[model samples]
Target chain A: MPFAPALHSEWLKIRTLPSLAAGPAAVVLVTAAFTALAGLDESAGADSDPLFASLFGVVLGQIAAVTFGAQAVSAEFRGGALRLSLSAVPHRGRWFAAKALAVGASALAAGLLAGCASLAVGWAVPGSRAGGPNWGEGLRGVVGCGVYMALMALFAAGLTALLRSGVMTLSILVPFLLVVSFVIGGVSGTAADYLPDKAGQVVLHSTSDGALGPWTGLAVTAVWAAAALAAGAWSVRRRDA
Target chain B: MTSIDVRDLTKEYGGRRAVDRLTFSVRPGRVTGFLGPNGAGKSTTMRLVLGLDRPTSGTATIGGRPCAALDEPLREVGALLDTGAAHGSRTARDHLRVLAATHRIPGRRVDEVLEEAGLAAVSRNRVRTYSLGMRQRLGIAAALLGDPRVVLLDEPSNGLDPEGIVWIRELLRRLAREGRTVLVSSHLMNETASFADHLVVLGRGRLLADTPVREFVHARAEPRVRVRTPDGAALRDLLARHGYESVAEEGEGAGDRWTVRHARVDDIGRLASGAGVTVLELAAEERTLEQAYLDLTAAEAEFTAMSPSRAQEA
Candidate 1:
């Protein structure tokens, strides 16, 4: 069968599965809710970057992206799901491609919606309206929020496929993204800047001190996602169902 | 009609061989029973045929093409390797729809199979709520959605009730009758014997017997004669005079029925007629398929449950 039908079938699977569909919806709710709460916080220095402060909820929202991507790929490793899928579409490459497309497209749509909702709420705070709709760095950050989250999701998906598990991916990632990059990197040095999550999030910062710029950081993240996806694809073809 | 051809196929996981140099061909218009003990590699061989697992050597093909090479595999072969492979969250109809969408199979075919497998009532319910037997029926429904020419079922009768067993037996026979190749695996020798036209017995990852069901039972099991007459004592005395030892069955009607070992029905009939004894029934009592299977596997089987002492020693 062609890739169109395979993609359609995968889309149906995602829609029919409540947990699978919840991942993306959670991104919008959590990101928008947290960003709105942060908008009410009054303890802010005059020199502080307000956009970064308001958009900080992305740290939590991106986890939802990771979950969506990881669960989508890891689901195949559970029970006999892989066997049934492969039996339906014998070509391993086509199956993986359809899965990657489904995950990427879903994350993209969710990320864009969450980014817009969070940005609107962030702008709603009394101080954020002081210089409203700059349409320069502010617009870029909003768009970048969507792109960065989507990339994070795809990255998680590719890694999940390589590991052939959702729990293992989440266990390693939920900590690395939430804690290690912030705490350990705080005491350590510039190494965190090169990590996928940290590097990808560079676009969220209006002004950053780093050798890599916003687009370059995303490009680096894209490379990582590509490499991981290649490894995952190779693993799927090489391993026995 | 289609055929499944496995040629010198072998599979090794780690260092242990799972399916060793197995070669067999299943032809259309018949139900070929794939019989084996637990871990005898029946599932593994079927996986190889479906291209779910790569064979360490050789190839298994359907209609002269590897399963992987088929552009539309569902149209060629329908296989049931794992019944519960579906996600627990999806409904029976949803599960079939997703699979069918890949091959563009219509929704009507899905309903038809749901009805055929007796799963139409619960088609909208989640798979997690279905019983093991119901899950098996859904799996069968998925297999039939594409109108396949060859069907490979692994332990298709597992977790089914007696009525379901009879249903599957008739289904396989009917599928074979329609000239579709049907290969079913089961440890229940008696149940398989009721439907299987041919037998493929495996033991310790090797082919032990691959022949017609009738020929296999006759070759492996003992042939006995059951004689029922009004004068059982006269029949026994007459048989003993001819150096034929006989014993009555252990039941309420034992006095009326005598079981003669290593005897032919024709000989017993002739002897009974010469003796002028009234005979009601005299027929060859062929050993059941289960007994024949045990007899054949006794020499080929390698694994058996360990006794308490053996376990302690190990």
Candidate 2:
């Protein structure tokens, strides 16, 4: 496709990290674990859809996205290889764009596999008649989850560039996504709706609550992703490698 | 022809000036050695040229264009900032292949570079498993993958063994002969002295000397004639009469022995013969590059007196 060389280089980098393997592996394991949990629950209910129950793995799978996002740029900074990478591709903005594309593609692929596997396992289990969630809606949910994961990864990448430390990036992101959202949800009723996880999870629901339609939630997540990516791009372009 | 022109390049790190008004040009088809002590801003200058660091003032351009302006930078300039900069988990071949993919270079080119760098046997091995010398070779291979017109290497010999060092020296020379601009930086004066045709010497974040290697050696080196003779005092006196000072040999049983400072070989022979002292052996001792470098940077040495920290810093 004649994409920037930096993009190809970044894809190679993403594939090489031990953490990259961990992300997809985490997706599969978490999906299977959640599917088994849902299967064990005798009261999964006749009304409960298999897709929703099995796709519960998305919650845990998002953590993998966080890891992928952080490692995408954080590893370079930690290894002091940013200088080398920047030397290869001098245009800082273009380099970041390439990284975003490569990281996004990987996250999408992994998220889809996890989402599809969870759905398949849920449908295969006994006594779970709940299957029909409209093929289009289900497709949207799967695609949205992948996009959400990719965005989360980009968000993490930005935070890593700003923080410039792997531990610090993870420390800040984990709490914001996992803990702070829960705390805010408990403190204020409507705050969770705006949180990234909350907004992203809205895609999984086949029926729309008046709060935010599925597409609207995806847009909300996209806004968060765009903001984080913009901030990351700015930092990468302005700061010394 | 690909030439690197750096004009008044200055890079400030917070309050500290990493590179202060550094100006120099690396011409095509020459091995230009960048010489400096630790913290003399050799790496910083290179970073500026590659556009890895923003210059506070001035500019560094490759082939009349800023590095950032190049459409396919690797095809024009290949740089090795660090030998071990690749991801540890990736194989050496994969690292090179990924870089090759960037410029749409064929896979065959990657294999060629691997063979050229003598890394074909271990191309499949993980980078982390390679020794420092191997990593350096891999980096050189990556730099040469695009058949670049200009190659910028920073301390490429830092971790290499004697054989590897010689290999790099020959490789650089060959590359230069093939019309590529090869710029290599090193703090080791002797290493560059034998290999470099031109030199850009730096001290204390400033340019100290930029001249042909021959000129630098000739201007700074003071050749002395070494003689072994029983009547050393008579020869020393005869040389002293000709307006030269001599320092007596300082050791036990070293009777009447002395070494004259900066005495030319012909002058010593003539002075000894005129004084009736039979010179047992007389030969001109070519001044080593180490001596010349020490004399050149004595005043601006970062560490006036050596210590543990200085050793660690270097």
> What DockQ does every candidate get?
0.79, 0.52
To one decimal, what is the Cα RMSD in angstroms of model 2 from the true structure? 3.9
**Steric overlap count per candidate:** 0, 1
Alpha carbon lDDT at A215, candidate 2 = 73
Q: Candidate 1 at B245: error in angstroms? A: 4.6
lDDT of each model, Cα atoms only? 0.85, 0.79
Please give, for residues B1-314, the per-residue lDDT of candidate 1 as tens digits. 58999899899988677887998999999999999989889999999999989999989999989998899999899989897788889999999998998998889999999999999999999999998888888888888889999998989888988888888988999999999999999999898999999999887577888899999998888778998888888999999999888998753653388899878899999999998999888899968999899988875433333345423422
The sequence of per-residue lDDT tens digits that candidate 1 reaches over residues A1-241 is 6899999988988888989989889988888888777667666555545566556678899999899999998878887889889988999999998988888888888877887787787887665535543557667777777788778888888889889998999999999988988775543237777788778777777776776788988888888888888888988888888
- lDDT digits (tens) for residues B1-314 of candidate 2: 98999999999888677887988899988899999888889998998898877899999999999998888888888988877587788889888877776777888999999998899999999989999999999888988887889999999997888899999999999999999999999988888987889999887678988899888877887777677777766776777788887776653453454666787878888878877898777777787777777778985564534656544533
Give model 2's docking category.
medium
For candidate 1 chain B, which ten residues in a row score worst on lDDT? B301-310
Off by over 4 Å in 2: A1-6, A16-18, A42-51, A127-137, A186-189, A208-210, B250-257, B301-314
* Model 2: per-residue Cα lDDT at residue B251: 38
Cα error of candidate 1 at position A164, Å? 1.7
